[model samples]
Target: MILLDEAARHLKASLKDMDTVVLTPRLSQVYAGINGHADLLVHKLDDSTLAVAAECTDFFKNLGLHYNVMPIEGIASPYPGHVQLNIAVFGKWVIHNMKVTPEPVRAFYERQGYHFIHVAQGYTKCNLVVGRRSLITSDVGIYRTLKDIAPILLVESEHVALKGFNYGFLGGASGLINDTLVFAGSLERHPSYARIVKFLDRQGESWTQLQGPLVDVGTLIQI
Candidate 1:
């Protein structure tokens, strides 16, 4: 089920827990660095990511984690589904754009215990992992809606990178492992890095900055 062994190696090394991992094919030719963006390409009711998920599922299952693949289709036409599965899940909340999320995936989330909340913007990539009870985002709508129930920080999006787009998102450049939050780029360059760090520190959470620009690689999923 492995498409590129070298890329898988890099992915394994980037993860804090390597006992079992699910690797996806990369979209970027520069596979040496952490290119998680290339790996996640989910859509609504499509089989676009099925093959990769199947392979990764097998890979993880062999490691005794009882992993299974649920390949989701990416969006169609002009826009790319680079962050299709980028919805944020914590406790009973599933924060995302209900209009774009795949029905199967949403149903799966419900079966596993999650409630959906619709937001106008589909840029769920700007999320910063702060456990289920808290989250960090640049989208004003989300911040306003979830702020009362969950601890949240609204950071400006001018500093993030999206390559083809205007800017990258916070969630796309972030990943959660155990209690550590890893960012694709250094927070030092972010205008609100200090405030962002302070927010996490107060929650007893620590962050690790990965070497590279703040590219939106989509959410690094653990399954």
Candidate 2:
């Protein structure tokens, strides 16, 4: 609770009553700042940087959150079971679930993608909600922030804040936040997007790192 508490220390607003909030994929990193506003926020925590993960390992714990290995475990029933979606795409971070790690992936393009979406550049789009709305977003960090900000406000507002405002909102990026927050666009662009959703739903398991109102991580794996 420390991380959540500290993040909420400066803001006096009741998270449950928030109307809306804008979040970026950078919300995944600990250094990225998150506002206690918005009734709902989608977020991320599935950083692929082993070095950064080691450095920021305790960051989430310090905030009262913990990170786990979420092992890929082996292939399950469907083999392609949970689609392996990435939040990075075409060397940019517009947000998509269709992209994969890419075979023989290009270094320059990938780097550009991160740069465009990284928190420092300010181009991440994802979050979470937990007050009163059904709580929907495409990012994991934002989702966590929503969890942190919730309980401080009313529940009514949080319930419907994310009902059905998301549609035709897909760009490019298979990263966790993008996969979780994506509404619709073209699974063809990133088949992994649909695959992941299918896999998660089939497995009946959900993770805080990739749960959005429109797209649930559980469904990603299940579908």
Stretches of candidate 2 exceeding 4 Å from the true structure = 1-8, 12-53, 61-66, 69-122, 126-223
Work out candidate 2's RMSD over C-alphas: 17.1
In Å, residue 132's CA in model 1 sits off its true spot by 5.1
Measured by lDDT, the strongest candidate is 1
Q: Write the per-residue lDDT of candidate 2 for residues 1-223, one digit (tens) a residue.
A: 1112223222213211222212212223222222211111112323322111222334423433344422222211121211222222221332333232222223324554442222111212222221121233444443343444322111111111212333212211112222332222223333344544454455442323212222211111101
Q: Backbone collision count in every prediction?
A: 10, 68
Give the poorly placed runs of model 1, Cα more than 4 Å off: 1-23, 26-65, 80-83, 127-133
- Locate the minimum summed-lDDT window of 10 residues in model 2: 214-223
Model 1 lowest lDDT segment of ten: 43-52
Hey, what RMSD does candidate 1 come out at?
Answer: 5.8
Best by TM-score: 1
TM-score of each: 0.71, 0.21
Predict model 1's lDDT versus the native.
0.57
Cα lDDT of all candidates, in order?
A: 0.57, 0.25
